[model samples]
Target: MTVTTQPDYRCTPSPLHAILLAGTVPLFLGALLSDIAYYNSFQIQWTNFAAWLIAGGLLFAGLALLFALANLIRADRKAGRPVMYLVLLLVTWVLGLVNAFEHAKDAWAVMPSGLVLSVIVSVLAVITAWLGLSNLRSGGAR
Candidate 1:
């Protein structure tokens, strides 16, 4: 008797791609922290820090979104996990952009709304990172 096994071709991100996906969490979380600090201390510098961090987060998230798009295209079947991940990435990027615009307002005006958006964007970014980096493999058999 001959023993044969099927190969499992897992669809996963490359190391650099994974790094880009992972990078969004901290930058957004840092922005959230800055927003909180500004809310508490009423310091203008904190808003500046938050704005810069939001910009950085958007940069990384945009790169990761590109990678996710490539991954989705490279996928054998465009049905489940890849689609979901791509959607998540898109939502995160869009909301992050909105948060950036919100932060563009005056220091005092940025408050409350900016802080709320930061929290929501930060949560979305973390979820996107988690989903993108997790072991949710596509095009593989168990």
Candidate 2:
């Protein structure tokens, strides 16, 4: 009798992706606060720069996450859930980016809208990250 072992086809979630997702909320909050400060004080401070940096980082991270998810889906056709999560993440990221740009331009009128977008982005990022991490821990899709 001969016995054969099957290879595990499970794909592991990238730690960088998790980090990005986890950091999104805090970073957006920091940006929002900094934007508020800048507007209230009417002065350019370190917080302004920090907000821009965080927003730029998030934009890049969002793109990276989308790419990673796309690759995973391509490799495992069964992994469909993550696609929705990624899409939601990307949409929110774009909204956040728009807010970030408005803030950078010192358009205080847009701050309220940006704040709302940032909150939405944070929620979506958290959900997406949780789903990705959970799927990876559970050995991925069926």
Candidate 3:
């Protein structure tokens, strides 16, 4: 009798996925900064900038979330970081959408809530990006 073993393979994000994931952090961070400026100066322009930045962040995070879902589906082991990453990305994308809606309101009305949402979304984006880009590997015999 002959014995055979399956080769070990690793699951990781593609280059494009990494780029999209990386893009979310900066855009969200920029939105957070804009929200801070708007809060401090009460400048409507700052709010406008924040809205645009949040939109861009949402776009990137949405794409990254799709990639994360794909990866989660493809991964052999889905119990650890992969599941957490997908959940975080989903939460970030959803909250980002809500923040966008909040920003759509009047500049003065966007205060407090919008800023709070921005802060949360920004932190989530950073965490999602970090989780997506880090060296998380799952390898085993197929």
TM values, all candidates: 0.90, 0.64, 0.88
Task: List model 2 lDDT by residue over 10-93, tens digit each.
Answer: 455567766666666666667666656655775566346545755664765576577666655666454455556566667767
Task: Report lDDT (Cα) of residue 47, candidate 2.
Answer: 45
**Alpha-carbon RMSD, each predicted model:** 2.5, 4.7, 3.3
Model 2 clashing residue pairs (backbone) = none
Could you say which candidate leads in lDDT?
Answer: 3
Over 34-141, each residue of candidate 1 has an lDDT whose tens digit, in order, gives: 999999999999999999999999899899889888877877777677788899889989989999999999879998999999999889888877777876666554
lDDT of 2: 0.60
lDDT of 3 by residue, 21-137 (tens): 999989989999999999899889999999999999988888888888887787777766778889989999999999999999996999999999999999999888888888665
Best by TM-score: 1
Report how far residue 99 has shifted in candidate 1, in Å.
0.3
Per-residue lDDT value at 11 in model 3? 59
User: Using lDDT as the measure, what is the rank order of every candidate, best first?
Assistant: 3, 1, 2
Model 3 superposed RMSD (Cα): 3.3
Which of the two, 1 or 2, has more TM-score? Answer: 1
